[model samples]
Target chain A: MSRTTVVAALAAGVLLVAGCSSDEPAPAPSSSGGAATADAGQDHDYTVEGFASSVLGDGTLDDLEDVGSASGEIEGGQVEAQIVSVVADAAGTELVVVLRGDDTGSPSRWSESRGVFTDVRGVEVVDEAAGWRLQPYTILDVSGESDLGCACSEFPYRLGEDGTVVQALLPPLTEGTTSVTVALPGLEPVPGVAVTWR
Target chain B: MQTRPRRTPRWPVALLAAAALTLPTAPAHAAAAPEPGSTVDVAGVDVPVHGTFSLRAAGNASRDLVRGAVHGVRRVEGGTAVYLSLGLPASASRSLPLSSIFTRSRDYESSALAAVTLVDRPGMTAYVPLRGGDAAPYSSDVSEFRALKPGELVVLWAVFPELPAGTRTVDVLVGDARAAVTGVPVEDGALEPVADDLVPQAGEGWPKIAEGDALAGAEAPWSVRPLVQHRGSVDEVTDVAETAEEVDATLAADVLFDKSSATLTAASQDAIARLAADIAARGTGEVRVVGHTDSDGSDSSNQTLSEQRAAAVVAALQPASGTAVTFVAEGRGESEPVAPNTSPENMQLNRRVTVSYQVQEATR
Candidate 1:
């Protein structure tokens, strides 16, 4: 098959289809099923949203991957980040993913001139057919101030359907939680990256 | 793993090809370059030699390979000449190659001499080869040994190429330095060969063995006790066991006195003090002191001089008195010797006394 289809197929194969296919028609107008339907419908209303934050790339997450460029979204108090470049520490215990903003109104680049933040507790890993699945929590640590300290210890996170972290080692965050941040040794205007949660 | 019987080294296909054709025979010869280092073999390694080594047995050797070298080795067959190569630095002696013996003018003629001495057998030869599988016959003559200078290293290899061979040991002596190597005979000759049996690899075990210790966790009896327990005192056994309570304190010392003199030398003082301490520690034991002399003087004078030496020691011990003492002095002049009578040290052992303790019985 084509490379695009293969990559997509690999990604989909990891979803782990567990339920059997149904053949019978749905029942009409069941009074007892109404309450359950309402709850199920409410769970689907989850709109990709999260708080915006950045962290040091000191192994606060597992299963971190590199995206093409750093452009992400912040929705529903949750940050959805698309990280491009990744930097691993000398000891292989921490990883840093460069974050960027890709919304039509603004484009972002991997630079040190800007601020980046993320929640240290959001990193998780999930093992799926498509290698490992990484799920991060909401960007709960974004303080808006540009002086986010050194990028020596924060990292960007990759999200999965089920919040599971996949990186081998994660460093404790400033608040004694897991977090990571990626920095290009001497670059300014550090790009803006966001995080999303399940 | 199944152990297959040892056999001759599997010669390369090319070597076997050469072996098939009959070659001319000649007396064994060494190569142009002699072994240049100490020779040693690891234990249980099977080494073999054919080709040139084989030709030596046929009595048609072309050139002498081990020209001038000292050797110490044991060979499988009889009649091989064994020689020890000397005159080189210890290191070079061990490495002098057997091949160094061949003369250029002679075009490497095989010499019948063995490097080390061995009992003569009609057609037996020991062919030694390097780890790289080169063989040279042992040489037998002191003149053939290559002279060694300072700071040279030589490695000599002992060749043993036969099957059903027992473990053979050889001490390779290079001047004063020595090393050892063992050889295992591999095979008789290349005939019907058995393949080695394959065994399970390490880390993989049968489940039965993994179960381990059929009687593990079986009941066992064990006990522990404190260092001291307060039990009522039991009856004592006759206060103390009947044993020797006294020790000998009188010791005879002989000092090399100036001719016909009674004066004791400074060396005699320490020996006399040790005797005094022993006597002071003995509760009330009698001391019998004796002395002897070397066969250097007339019998009567030696005896008199010995008595005087014993008296000197007694005089020194009398000052340290903690026990009653009885001094019985005797002299034996050159009557008995402990070592060779020729050395001064042997004479010293002869001129001494042994003390014995005589504890008196309790007075009823």
Candidate 2:
């Protein structure tokens, strides 16, 4: 198993610190489930910040929770990802994740197959208490047609220097467990991510 | 060592528990915890097979795991309930088959130390989880154990067919030798809440979200844990499954075909030919070859890829089987999935190829 170094820096700004969890970094995870990290030796430099995102930001914009912004960089120019808000979804456990790829003096491009929409399935969430590590699923229609993509940002475009795509992780975690860890293929494991129940 | 205020056993549950008492060779013993700290060393991993038992018990005295912390085997409405809140030690062996008692046999994985026995009646009434519904029954929850961290705790349960009412004390046999719990109490009462983790979570009611093509489509309960039925045999060597009616062989698409490509893996013809030679002896009629893909790409793309992969397998297997079986190729696309497309293990299972031939009547 290739080791990916995680820059355990807590970034400030739009991201709010979650008071619910321990600051201790999660123990190293087993690489048994990391098929997407096929690029084993790909040198990874990323940051993981776990916090609470309290805002719904729509009609319930005024009714906000602790929805925070954090990012983990797998590659220098690839993208930055974070589990913005993890909520108790009707289906199970859901997480609103963001992947930003807008960096100056680096690659700034969105292809048809690449970027956040396609990479949504690469996000992994784990509830250690429940012994669950949920994989990404493509939500489908009743007729077994793959029309709309998963509950993620579709056809996303960058505004100025900001390139962000939000994807929802459908929950299938056990009912009793909540706090979890989030990680992309090459991303270091981020622990103490809270799950807000709806 | 604390006891939960015992609720008197229910009527039907009591009847079954009492009845089970007759099956065991030894007369029912008083509820007693298995020898605490009982452990078996398997492949250098100290697996916690033995633990405390009964809903009356609170925690296990084992060093490696805290098993059945909440509930033991209890009679529910339809069947007997087996619930466990496991707490693992820092060096606990991380394998599901080593920990949880599955309700049935699984599709793929099997360990030498697999198969936990409800060793109550010795010869007659000892039951393992039922042989599974379909597809060579396999535990769909392998990822949980593999992903287990050091000293982490996870919960698992299975509802087996009810035991006799008199079965107050029973032994939970884990692996080949070790009895996980001895003389565990079997009480009757309300069944605990079922853990919903077995079923992969989906967006409720197929609700369409967002207006874009990349939006989160609704989760339609179409695909299920694919089943294989009736008389069957599994070849762990070549990854083939056979039943009384048909001889079906499964090969992972990952091994047969590379990423997005329909071509077979380089220099892999010898393996397929070896597989063909084995199945040809009993296989008859047309060999139906089907391919499947994971839910990564778009539907149409994955469909095309699946079809191409199927055709590729057919091409490779055609000459190997000789004129005994005609190879027919088709791709069900991403439709039929053995597991949910949510995790690496499940997705790997979803991407696969199957070659089927009717079993010779004489052989059956």
Candidate 3:
């Protein structure tokens, strides 16, 4: 029960899978598993390595703890993240994770520089029991470009003073599941986040 | 996966939690947000407050009807086409934030007000439109939706990946609100292909559901083709998604270049050669090589690096992919990403070189 594994592959030009783990194994990474594999012919360039993994976090949903609203902060150097709320809609699990800075100075000192906070895809929804991670839901324009500015906090993001609130909308967590986890990028996973309904 | 019966009988909040109901822990459901409209339930999904989405109810299933609409959806080869006809009741003068209402894709909250959703109850999965169904400003490039007067209906449709096999009924939600609609059966047969004109607009008057065909020519042709990645085996550097005609291959930037440099790494050459050979066998003629980067550096620098990397890929693949194939290189900075730049694993996907080409032989 201690060393449960959830392996997510980083397929070069092919996948956007997260290296997320929980108490169970991960579901299939992509939608269809019928595409030509590395051994199907073009075996030269297929690589599942050179990952950009979390420097501070290991991206694991440790022990299935149902400690509703564990106030323990997911510390990320200058900035800290806390699960504000978990609102359940029909298919959308809208989570508000407030991020703030402990040591205020220039924004450069913060762990989540500009790169991570700017794009809304930073947050992902992990269904621990199902052992699959859902990508952030994004509203797309005609040309297939996503407009996720409303979903999360915008950057140059004042991670100081009041700190910014990052609202990530993801697919609904599995039914009957009581609690889940939330990890803000470089920060560790905040376990036992309650799934509240309206 | 066991299909639990629909949660139609929702007892009091505290009791329901103690009992066998599958609803979320809504300790705040009865407490915080309470609106005007009475409680309406669809396949166990509680439309929190039915007041906001004041539309008419159809039959026992309570299909949310705005005057009338195409009953079910057109199940196409690529996906399903949902043509909805929405209208406000005569007395209720409501301003529909068109974008907010239908913008609810599989995993997005378009706005705070309401987001549309389609639930495959049996499959226990929710699906948003793969494309289309967005309101005027975004979907049509027309005008932003003005406040819709009563008796006026908006005919909007979107394309979604084909429903899970054996799935018949789907629940439609506009911000947790599904007036009477949910449990709509999947229409029989394939979606009729017409001149794509499923324009999202508030029409002059209400549309009668005289026949349940594809909204009397309210179908959308795929501008964005159905793209699927085959991932049975583990492949690190090259990831590919293919349409019947085009194959889009994404190669890892880490393996291909040094930090901020476009110069192809010596090790990546072998990989490129393999990819080139694959393309040469399948490609008909033209190949577009586009470069992308993760959001780590400044936007300007990322753009420059992406462009340079694309050119390098083109140089590497042009000769190898056959003389008949022409390679063109383009750069999309940190704009379009397959994954969020949150973790290193996600960021690695953003930094890649994508080479797309037409497939001469149809390969699924």
Q: Residues B276-351, candidate 1, lDDT per residue (tens digit)?
A: 6645665365666666677888899988887887676567657874547767666776776655577676665565
Residue A6 accuracy (lDDT) in model 2 = 14
> Which one is best on TM-score?
3
Across B161-277, the per-residue lDDT of candidate 2 in tens digits comes to 456665664445332212144444565643322224442111001111111122122111221111122111122213443333555667777767778999998645655786677
lDDT, candidate 2, A116-180, per-residue tens: 44334445566565344564333232243332233222322331123332443333465756677
Which scores greater on TM-score, model 1 or model 3? Answer: 3
Highest DockQ: which candidate?
3
Candidate 1 residue runs with Cα over 4 Å from true position: A1-198, B1-260, B358-364
lDDT tens digits, residue span A1-198, model 1 = 222232233223222211223322111111221111112223210011100000001111222454423223343122233342222221112222322222232222222222233222222222122122222211111222122112122222223222211111221112221222332322221233222210
Tell me the whole-model lDDT of each prediction, alpha carbons only.
0.27, 0.41, 0.44
Global fold similarity of model 3 (TM-score)? 0.35
Residue B252, candidate 1: Cα error in Å is 8.4
Ranked by TM-score, top first: 3, 2, 1
**Candidate 3 residues B1-364, lDDT tens each?**
2122122222232232222122222111101111222221211222212111222221101222233233335465446655454554333335444442343344322321223345553343455444323232112221334343443444544445567667776644432223223445565443222223333322121122112232222233322223222211022566554434567677899999998899999979877987899777878777998899999999999999999999999888888887658878899999999888988988988999988888775432
After superposition, the stretches of candidate 2 with alpha carbons farther than 4 Å from their true spots are A1-198, B1-238, B243-247, B343-346, B358-364
